[model samples]
Target: MPTTRNFRTRRRRLSWPLIAGIIMLHLAALYGLARALAPDFTAVVEREVVSAFTVTITAPPDPPPPPDNQPEPDEGAAGDPGRDAVPQPVTGQPPKVRVKRDDPLPRASSTGTANQSGAATAGDGTGAAGSGLGTGSGNTGSGRGGVAVTKPVHISGSIDNARDFPVPPGGRAARRGTQVIVRVIVTPDGRARDCRVYRPSPDPEADRITCQLVESRLGFRPATDANGNPVAAPFYWRQEWF
Candidate 1:
């Protein structure tokens, strides 16, 4: 039998372009299928990605100093009302009015006898004793009075918290001296539940943004009552742009 040589099959490597083309074709087919399933794929709203900035307003510069040599204005003198009036000569004998003389006090007679009954009583214009009001205690009720409920005390709330606001594009209505006052309603769970613009800024959008920012960033512990019970309360804070 003659000897025969066996050769192994050679493996070929794919070119980068061919590989990229295959990948692109596969992606295209997948995209077509996805588009067919859902035509309005892009209609879903997504969270906007934006850069945030903390805004603060700088205090206005101190007013210019007054001139050192400025003359002080003198205050007007107060005039006496009677100074200009001339006294009328005795006003015709002072109008002749009669004054009644008080009569002398009556003297107690020696023949009058003292009260025969010996029961003692006391009264200082208040009332008779035990007539529903002579007791020293404040209230007439025998039971102790109820404690008064004072206003709720705020345990924790950020009044001066620096908040982050998204910087809008093109700087529209983002000028200085703009401020918005927001009222945040804090629940008993120490969370900000609702927010509304208490005082709106010049720009309407600024007022809306103020509420949104407060609802997301602001945190507060509910106001506590005199008995330390947590309650829902509104907290006001201001944000200004500069």
Candidate 2:
């Protein structure tokens, strides 16, 4: 009866490991919450910096030119207003250059006349001895002395009738030797006009009759000038009465 009192004993429901795991889970949750809600400690800064650099360009040197020694022309020498005026700058177009032409030769030296020397150069006659230029010859070849006659007109045989000619009457001694000299003008149209007796025959009737026949019924080949133009020519002739 001295030790008869009953004692109650309880069994463990949860282990110590379980209790420890529960405590670790609670610490991780609290750490995550604190990290999410905590203030940021990182710093941010904004700055503007200007950068500068220097650049250099170099040019090539030009060659030196020769120096001019001639003196400039005097502008005031002539006292011309246009020449003395200041030269205006031309910008729209290029400057114009003037070209000069030389003058022609004078009249004295320009014309060359044919002389003896020129004649020696030209031939005269048909054969070698005669085949040299004659004395002073004109352009028309009338030469120098004499009448300067070109081509003399002849009496036409067809137009001059024998019956129309003068009898040239004279004295018995001078009849056959009687001579008549006359000058006639031949027109450009081949008409013989202005007949005059320069030297009459011994017989006056013969002289008058000769002049009349020449003026009325004579035809001539007109002469030409140096220029080859047909013109009236004065002709002289002498006739001996037969």
Candidate 3:
């Protein structure tokens, strides 16, 4: 047995419009991809931001007015007589004066008597005992009631007259003619009782020997009062030694 075969065939053709539409779609997609991948050319503009605030300012208050009760100065009172007057200076008390005093003269005679009762007491013409100024029997007032000293103490003889003075070993090296001053106290008998150096020499040995030489060997004339009586007194002795 033979079977019959049936074959159906349909043929479709692409039209020009369909092909153009597909090509235009592909071209549009390619253009969109290019546009997304490529860099954009846009203009860049800088914008500055500014901030504003509101502020309130107030001025200081006005000064207060003067008081109504205050009195004004008088311009006419500037020429007042008391304001132009000169003031007198005050005087102080004067200083006191000092009086001079005269002392009474001393007398050796017992007949003289000084009356101290009044400042004007007058003495006898012979100057025995009145407070008045007159010639007296004594030499002069000792400044005290005793007789005044007439002669002062002095060296009797040359200092070379003393016993041989031995110089120390180093005496030659000292300054030549160095002077030493010593104070010697003499008794009424014209003998030196005490001695001390008043002024020192440049050499120490000279000063040490001065007192010993003055007290041991030096002699002095005793000081005499106005009545020629001997009295103890001090004498200054100056000597040169190497």
State which candidate has the highest TM-score: 3
**TM-score of each predicted structure versus truth:** 0.31, 0.34, 0.38
Steric clash pairs (candidate 1): none
RMSD values, in order shown = 51.6, 28.5, 18.5
Per-residue alpha-carbon lDDT of model 2 for 69-172, expressed as tens digits? 89988876765456467788887876777778665444454355532232343356422223233334334233221232356476573323435454433434
lDDT of 3 by residue, 118-230 (tens): 33434443354534323342333222233427544555545553234455466554546678888876666778766778898776666767677677776667777766766
How much does candidate 2 score in TM-score? 0.34
lDDT of 2 at 59: 78
lDDT of every model, 2 decimals: 0.58, 0.60, 0.62
> In candidate 1, what are the lDDT values of residues 1-242, reduced to their tens digit?
99999999999999999999999999899778877787676233111222234457899999999878977666896655775678777745667678997754335444435433322344322333332323231222111121223322335433243344444555635546678887776655666656877888777776786777666665665565555555556677788876
Could you tell me which 10 consecutive residues in candidate 3 have the lowest summed lDDT? 41-50
Q: How far is candidate 1 from the true structure (C-alpha RMSD, Å)?
A: 51.6
Q: Which candidate is the best by lDDT?
A: 3
* Steric overlap count per candidate: 0, 2, 3
Against the hidden true structure, what lDDT does model 2 obtain? 0.60
| Two-way TM-score contest, 2 vs 3, winner | 3
